[model samples]
Target: MNFQINKDVLLNNLIVAQKALSNKTPNPALQGIKIEVFKDHLVIITSNSDIAIKLNVKDSSLDVKEEGSALIPGKYFIEIIRKLDALKCNLSIVADNMLRIEADRSDITLNMMDLEDYPELEFSEKIKSVKVNVRTLKTIIRQTAFATSSIENRPILTGVNFKIDANKLTAIATDSYRLSQKEIELQDTYEPMDIIIPGRSLEELTKILENNNEVVELHFDNSKILFKYGNIKFQSRLLEGNYPETSRLIPTELPIRIKFNKDSLATAIERASLLSSRDGNNAIVKLSVRPDNVIEITSNSPEIGKVLEEVYPVDQIVGSPIKIAFSSKYMMDALKIFNSTEITVNFTGEIRPFIIKGEYDPEMLQLILPVRTE
Candidate 1:
């Protein structure tokens, strides 16, 4: 395509579109960014097998000399533009399908990929779509996506389950050992729907979203979901197969609940994990509530010394004394996402899973399954 645009504006949008650009794909076309030029604006498209992104660039600095389209090597094009010190850059296709880049003094040309090989992408919006607040969407992803299983053995568990019933939207993710769930209220009601989106896709989408009061339009289909925000359209392929029923996994009755300062408890666990034994990457740490109501976090390794850290409960512990051992990494990950200063850990039993909730973080829960210890 032939166009002239401000350097910063083009570079910024390229960074966002690059999230979907494939580096090691067998298809070479996926490594190229498709640039569509119109009289008023420029459109950039990038996609891999799992996700795709399309963003429109309309700025006062944009001056279109001609309207055309080209598939340029994504990596080389972005790097050439980024290194240019000029205020504006001009991109045009010359003879032999070469993309010529010209700025103040830098002149470079990159071999263009075949436009015929580029897959046609459809970004059409659905008739009825769900709208979610930008900040709330980010919150949901930040809180739940981390808990998705990274292992590929259980492929279904590698995605976050999204369920919509009326105005309520619930997102749940678990890696068997730990689980995270967050719910948010939509402005308008939508028909019941359920889907699983890959955690990696959600994580990449979240990075491109801005924190604001803007509403994100969600268009859903049977196999793919599209997120329309501002001038950007992000699409991702949904995971196949039904997600496991997670409702029964959560305990309805928690006999013992203890509130603790989030920072204090996290720090104690971090200290204990320093000398603890490991199960894979999990550093096991023990939490105990004495009859006197005092709490202790302990870790021990025969080859290393032991650590015993005392932390007082923010509120009186409920029910009988209990001791539980769990991975310190999982607990700290769940704690770091909380917005509240204080958090409550509800325990069903020493061996059963316990959940953590925050007063400020309504409708969000983090659960950890305890490990057996001697």
Candidate 2:
């Protein structure tokens, strides 16, 4: 294909498309990015089988000398584009399957792969779609994606479950040991959707998206899901199997309630975790509630000394006095996801699962299983 595109615009699209290129694949063509020059737009596509990306460069932003297509190595193409200094770069395809790229002072020739071998992203005419704000989608995933299971034995647990109905959209991620759930209302009513998206895919998508107020179109078929935002299109395979039902784990009645500053609780747990090791993965922080509504956090290690941290709460509690031991890592993660200044920690009982919620709303909640230190 022959086209003259702005160096910066080409470079940016290459950077995003490269995320799907796989170097270790058995198929050599998979290591390259497919560049298609159409009548009015240039399309760049890359796929590692599991995840695929397609980026478009409009004709208004570039000068077209000829219309064609080629598959060139993604790594070399990106590096060369970044090094070019000219406002626009000319890409021309020549005889003997050679691709020529020229800019202000640089001219590079690369052996092009057969364009026919490059896999094309499959899209269905009929699709179920939903609208989500780009900013809200990023934040919701960031808050819960961290809790997804990293283990390989249970592959389904490694993804975040997305359930969308006429009124609400909920995203839930858990590692069995801890869970995080974020729910928000939809702007308009639509069809119901239930799907599980891999955390890794969401993580990569979050990185490429800019911090702006834009809406992303979510389209799903039987096997794959597509996320189209701006000039980019991303598609990923859905994980199989039903996600575990978490509603039963959350208690309806919170007998013991305590509201504390999010930053203070996070800081105390971080310090207490310093004494904890990988094997134990445990930090026993004892909490004692006095008659005057004062709470003390104390942790002790046999090899090291003990630490006691005290933080005053803005709201007082009237529940029975209690002491609980839990994973310091889970506590820190749950606390970090709380965007509000104050977070409420509720306990059903010392041995039962405890819940953490944002002070202002119950839409976002975290559940942690207390460990028996004795």
- Please provide, for model 1 over 1-374, each residue's C-alpha lDDT reduced to its tens digit, 9 standing for 90 to 100: 68999999999999999999999998989999999999999999999999999999999999999999999899988888888999999999999999998999988888999999999999879999999999999999999999999999999999999999999999999999999999988889999999999999999999999999999999989899999999899999999999999889999999999999999999999999999999999999999998778899999999999999999999888888999999999999999999999999999998899999999999999999999987
Best by lDDT: 1
What TM-score goes with each of the models? Answer: 0.98, 0.93
Q: Can you write out model 2's per-residue Cα lDDT over 220-319, one digit (the tens) per residue?
A: 8656888898988988888888999988988899989998988988897778676653335556565667666777776777787777777676687848
* Reference-based lDDT, each prediction: 0.95, 0.83
Residue 213, candidate 1: alpha-carbon lDDT: 90
| List of clashing residue pairs for candidate 1 | none
Candidate 2 segments whose C-alpha is farther than 4 A from its true place: 125-127, 277-292
